[model samples]
Target: MNITKLIMVLICSAVLAGCASSNSGAVYKRGEARQVQTVKMGTVESVRTVKLEGTKSPVGTVGGAAVGGIAGSTIGGGRGSAIATVIGAIVGGIAGSAVEEGVTRSDGLEITIKLDSGGMIAVVQEADVQFKPGDRVRLLESGGTTRVTL
Candidate 1:
């Protein structure tokens, strides 16, 4: 591929990577700051490794399609090139979505915690921290979001 197309692919990959947002328990969104959170004490009942799915965004699909179309246009002359471009774009779009998802997928943890209030709940977050059974943790809940932290 030409330098321009290569640059475009690199940019698309960068954008897809940037689209991945943190789901770690230690990370908080700007809106979550200064807001009151209901703190609950709990003990970890179990910890399991999990896979976090990646994002499917138009940026990947469109970027791939554009690159594919350009690459395909260099095929046979006239109508044949047009058809190739269309086919290439469709195939590239599907491949791009899959690539985006795979690239953004991350490891996460499913933590089952037993609250001090006699309730059992399981929380999943990015596995940036380790947890084990019987470990004391805090469950911070606000705006329907709950995070397990030590």
Candidate 2:
């Protein structure tokens, strides 16, 4: 029964891992300032919807393999249990990886901008804000990252 509970927890973890988005392409809060610099001034040239793939880590595969191997080991007798454990671990690893990828998918936006410096650039970020053509914006730099904001 301990192994069964362990398997359940791992399954839940795999599901949750796939559903998590680590704000790779997200917006910063208004009025929230950090050690910041303005990278550029620009106008929105276009906005397009895009998809952001979810995070993929070995955690899911390892967890699933452990659970699968433990569960499989409980079946049959002697050598049969060992064979089942290996098969189960293989199947579980594949299924867990696929699940993590599918669950973590997210929608984003590709924003094309025409900079005042006479250059064009595009940023793909989580579509949490509405942007339209001709909107004035600025590129804020914090650390090694840049964000486009009004």
lDDT of each: 0.90, 0.76
lDDT of 2 by residue, 68-126 (tens): 77777787889998999899889877777777777777888799999999999998777
- What's model 2's overall lDDT? 0.76
The runs of at least 3 residues in candidate 2 whose Cα sits more than 4 Å from the true structure, single-residue gaps closed, are: 2-7, 10-21, 24-34
Q: Candidate 1, overall lDDT?
A: 0.90
Residue-wise C-alpha lDDT for candidate 1, range 1-150, written one tens digit per residue: 588778878888888888888899989999889999999999999999999998888977887888788778778989999999998888888888888888889999999999999999999999999999999999999999999999
Candidate closest to the true structure, highest lDDT: 1
Off by over 4 Å in 1: none
- In model 1, what is the error at residue 33, expressed in angstroms? 1.5
